[model samples]
Target: MKKLKNVLMVALIVLSIVAIAGCKNDDGNETTNDNKEVNNSVDSNDDKNNDDNDKSDTDNSDNAQEDDLSGLVSVSGSTSVEKIGIATAEEFMALNPDVTVTYESIGSSNGVKNAKDGVTIFGTASRNLKTEEKNWGLTETVIAHDGVAVITHPSNSANELTKEQVQAIYKGEITNWKDVGGEDEEIVVVSREDGSGTRGAFEEIVEFEDSLTKDAIIAKGNGNVQTTVAKNEKAIGYVSFTYINDTVKPFKIDGVEPTAENVVNGDYSISRPFLVIYKEENMTKESKAFLEFVLSDEGQMIVEEKGGIKVN
Candidate 1:
């Protein structure tokens, strides 16, 4: 009986040992599986974070590319385009504080020459490019259309004049205003100087050529023409439509009123294009941006506000 009891106690001890070993093995397996799951979850989170970081970096790079514009843009050209150009430049510079836009109001011919010679990045002109100019790698971008106003003193009684009558007056054939339905005073014809864009456009439109009277007063710019006409009651001159105001009276050409709407719709006879010329291959980023700005809604607003018609 003592031997049997000892055997039973040994058996009990063996069983306890086995049960503890079994529990240890099961716990080890559970611990290993939990570790594996935790590691996989951490790796997934890392990959997701890396992808989000990469996307954020790409977006920042794209934004930098879109917003990073800075440089010097030079503009030189037509006196006729001076107001619009300067006004646009002012607004553009305000938007891009790092950019500098310079405008020189030389004659249109000089503006074209300067562009070809690389003296200026932008060449503004009131007339369309000539055939020879197009062959020289100069591209004209027409920004606006403008009318040439035949202005006289407000005191002048001439309300309207036909094209032929204007040509006759410039030709010195109609020296007296009475001939064209005005006062009997002698008509003082004012003309823009040679190489003036306004003068060129006007002469070409009127077919005046060399027929303008030699005694006709020569003004340097539209402002001068307006000034001269404003001071003299018998004076008659032509200027850009932008220059027309209460200081002088604008005449109806062929019965159509000289106005921005009329000029844009082709109803006005004596009108010309306002052009900006550039070498396409040599254009800089800032210049391209400036061109875009000029065609934008804000730029068009500036054009209209400055008394010019917007083409775009």
Candidate 2:
């Protein structure tokens, strides 16, 4: 009886041991499966993040490449804007040596014509584009506001004149400076050639379009008009406000001086726009960048330094 009881106890102990070993094997498999699932999930997230980062990098790289520029840009237009344009070009070239910018101080009408015909990338005009010109799909950006100064030789005795009197003088009604309280000499009417932006603005402002005296001397540019008046003691002419130098004397109109401050305050009635024209649909990358720089704060500063009133 004792031996039978001892055998039963041993058999029960072996069964219990086998059962514990089975539980441990099942737990180990479940733990390994859970670890694999968690690791796989983490790896999948990491791959997605890497792909997004790669796409972001590509976009940034594309932008950086676009910012890199190199090419030639041609600008031509109003002689009035020539000095400012050249200064702007020089500064732009200094900053971007890879890009070459050239400016030609041809007449404003030629500049508009060239820009419309695609002969040049940019055109400068002292006057606003005509109504017919807007139909050509050309756009004008007013970069500055300038005054048309009524200038005379410093030897003249007249300090100022009424707007009507100035108009009459250009129209040949007041042929003698003595008629407007000047010397007894015959007024040497120095006028700009036709198609000159200065001429257009002056004629339009003075309300004497197509009526300038036939005997008036036609000068090609502002410098020429200044030169003519500078040497001739009896000469009277008009120029852009910037050209008002010691060589020539500026005449006040309607009790207001031809000054930047006067123009800004609307006291100067002979103010005109300085225009930069371009084609709306077909701007090159370099050309667009150049225009952006011209409108920038630095560019406007250059405009002021060059004796123009900033648009802003």
Candidate 3:
């Protein structure tokens, strides 16, 4: 009976060991396999996210390359070129968000001086450079053509004036409006001040020869001249044709109107060149690009829209 009991206990011990091994084989292997599969899925997802991030970075880099033009283009000179310069600069900058363009309207001669002195990246002149200015090695780029319009208060009766009459009025020889077929009011001659591009061109066209009448009221800038004439019914002033508004009447010169078409077609004789001057040796890349743009079809369109003659 004791031997039988010992055999029975050994059998029980063997059965317990077999059951423990079976549980481990079934549950532990399943947990390990599940963990392995989850790890692989997580790795796959991480790889996809990393690839997406890399592609995103590359796309941004390409976009940056396409719009990489960045620099300052500073243009100063010629109050008469104000509209043209501003229009072109604005459009250029809009296309190149990373670039900057600025225009400062001082005067034509000063603009040329600034270009030669390297004080500005570009300078504007409404008239051709003087012989000495050209001797300074500065180069001129003609952007557009402008006509000098002789304006008066809208109430004036005269619609046309000969070249000689316009010259005499500026020279103080024709002080009364009646002398020019207008009302008998005494003419208030408003002239642009010294250093003005409009004044230079007008004086040259009419053969003022530095002989502008001393009695003329000197106004600065086209706006100023426009204002002076618009307020005084007897006032007569000359401005860029672009500056003409309903506030003032632009007189016909020898039966030709001061229009862009007339100027480009060569019927408007009292015209001048609007120039952008620079030192070729010292020109920056940005200025060259801007000058090219100013001469381009889009640039000349702005010139025409601004009431200047298109060069192209």
Candidate 4:
């Protein structure tokens, strides 16, 4: 009876050990299956996230590159902004490589009208816009500052003049350069024709009426004024700052030199802000981007380097 009882106990122990081993194997298989599912799920989520990240990066990159204008840009209107526009366009083209800028130095009023009529993408002007211009859907942008400078032949030694004297000269009040500290030669004043921003600014500042007497000779453009003045020793003319390099010595008004620094600091009273006008009804992403660039720090640098006031 004792031997049978001991054998029964050993058999029960073996059965219990086998049952525990089987249960452990079942648990191990379930754990392996769960782990596989979790890994697959994790891999799917990671791939999905990676795809999203790649797409987002691509979109951002595309946007950054989209601002790069690779086509032609039509610029027109202000002779005052002509230099700045040309320089900025050249710089922009250098970076864009595939873009081109075509500019027309038409009168500012014509430019504003053309832009309002959707004839050009951009228009430049030397003066502020009129209320009627606003009614034409024109929006103004300040691109740079330009100083109206008095230019004469290199032979003339009149380096400075009071505002009153300058005004007198334009008004035919001072007919001779000798009257204002120069040679005894009679002064030949070259002026811009009507509808010219430069001429308007000069006349408004000096209070001269249209259709002046024989004392002042009205030319068409600033370039013509420069040429006419530079060629004649008795000639004096008001021209844009960009046209006043070695060819012409810009006179100091009331002993204050017209300079970019002076203009920025408000010491140059004849200085005016160069403007770009656009039609509000015909705005495009291209137009806004170009205008934004013109008003940016980089654009201001371009203006300064090209002899315009930094008005950023």
Candidate 5:
């Protein structure tokens, strides 16, 4: 009886030990599965964070590139282009605070010479490049179209003139306004000084190059011509269409009115190109940016606002 009881007790102890070992093994598997789930969650969160960080980096890079431009851009040339040039420079400088743009109102020929001599980044001219100028490796970019307005005093009765009539007046052939259908008054012809783009274009278009009468008064700039004509009832002069004001009246050429729309549509006969000249090889990044801006919609709007015709 005692041996039977002892055998039963030892069997019970072995069974308990086996059951405890089975429970421990099951707990170990559960622990390993829990650890794997935690690691997977951590990896997924890390990937999302990495993507967000990459996007942030890309945005910053783009901003840096957009705001990186800085330098000086110099433009020298046509006094006739002064108002538009200075207005453009003001707008460009406003947008690019780090850049400085300066323009000098030397005559158009001097503007070309200064650009060729590397004294300016851009040279503005109211006339197209001459054959000799094109041969100098200087390229002209026409930014705007302008009409050379034949202006006279408001009191003058003359409203229009043929190209031939205008040529005759400047050549001292027609000395009285009465010959051109105006009142009996002495015709006072005014012209621009030498190296003047306005004078160059006017002479070329009129086929009266080098034949301007010595008796004609020579003015320094477009404003001077406007002023001279305004002050003298018998005076006649030429200026950019941009300079036409209430003080002086513009004469129609061949019956076509001198106006911005007329200049753009090819109906105006006394029109010329407004140009910016530079060597392509010598173009700097700042200059390129400025040119691009001048051709932009906003820049062209400024051109129109300043009484010039937009070309681009």
Candidate 6:
């Protein structure tokens, strides 16, 4: 009876071992199938994500070339340097056919204020901004250098005037052209509007703050000042060298002509930097790229070609 019990015990042990092995084999097959499904799902999701990323990249590139710059970039200010801005804008539009840049020939002060108020993406200034302008969240980039030319109507044969004489005329101290050896006509003073950057430079350089309070015909811009001086025989106006041509004659200041070469070499007395202002926070990639192009050698060449002095 003891022998019979031992055999039964051995048989039970063998059956238990086989059952455990079979359960392990079933679990192993189930785990393998589960792992395969998980891997396939992971791979499919990864491929879908990769495709989405690729599509996003492609869209960005196309947008950079098309839709991103499809709107107008408003620029204003610095009548002293409007021609330069206009010419640059023309070329810039051509390169970035997606962007249309429109610049107004407003005076420099208006330009600074407009840019500060977020009315314009860029502001042109023939002079630097004052200390208070920083509060407007405006940052400036010097685009070019320019020299102010004292211009008179072509009929006036007076070739030049000393700095003192030019200052006196603007200050209302010297009223007659005859006093400066031109003609016997009263000097019709044509000056820029009060907010003009060129006007600030003119006053600062000649120390005319105390004396320029008198009334003078206030033309809106350098171009307007040139036109006013050219049309009126008795007029004398300060204009930028870029605007000087046959219609008006530029007067030598202290025996120096306001030529591009002179201005570049620091021989010109009334030279100032031309600036473009933009807001620090509102800058976009398009704005950054456009500005980068302007500051490049290609942009500087454009400035020189447009009869303006290149800064870099």
The TM-score, computed over Cα atoms with residue i paired to residue i, of candidate 3 is: 0.79
Report the Cα lDDT for candidate 2. 0.90
Give each model a TM-score.
0.88, 0.80, 0.79, 0.79, 0.89, 0.76
Off by over 4 Å in 6: 1-69, 213-215
Q: Please, what's the RMSD in Å of model 1? A: 2.7
Q: Residue by residue across 1-312, what tens digits does model 4's lDDT show? A: 999999999999999999999999999999999999999999999999999999999999998777556666788887777888888887777766667777899888888888888899888888777678878766787877788998888889788888788778877778887789899999898888777888777667766656355657878888889988878988888988888878777888988998878877888788677888887777665566667777888988988877787775
User: Higher-TM-score candidate among 3 and 6?
Assistant: 3
Question: Which of candidates 1 and 3 reaches a greater TM-score?
Answer: 1
Off by over 4 Å in 2: 1-67
Model 2: per-residue lDDT, tens digit, 204-306? 9999999999989999999999999999999999999878889999999998989999999999999899999989765788888888888899999999988
User: 2 or 3: which has the higher TM-score?
Assistant: 2
Expressed as tens digits, the lDDT of each residue in 70-170 for candidate 3 is: 89998999888999999999999998877899999899988888989998978998887888988998888888889999999998998899999999988
Q: Is candidate 3 or candidate 5 better by lDDT?
A: 5
Model 1: how far is 96 from its true place, Å?
A: 3.3
Candidate 3 off by > 4 Å: 1-66
In angstroms, give how far residue 235 of model 2 lies from its true place: 0.5
Better structure of 1 and 6 per lDDT: 1
Model 6: weakest 10-residue lDDT segment is: 63-72
Q: Which stretches of candidate 1 lie over 4 Å from their true place?
A: 1-22
What is the Å distance of residue 196 in model 6 from its true position? 1.1
Candidate 6 per-residue lDDT, tens place, 193-220, comes to: 7888998888888778656736689888
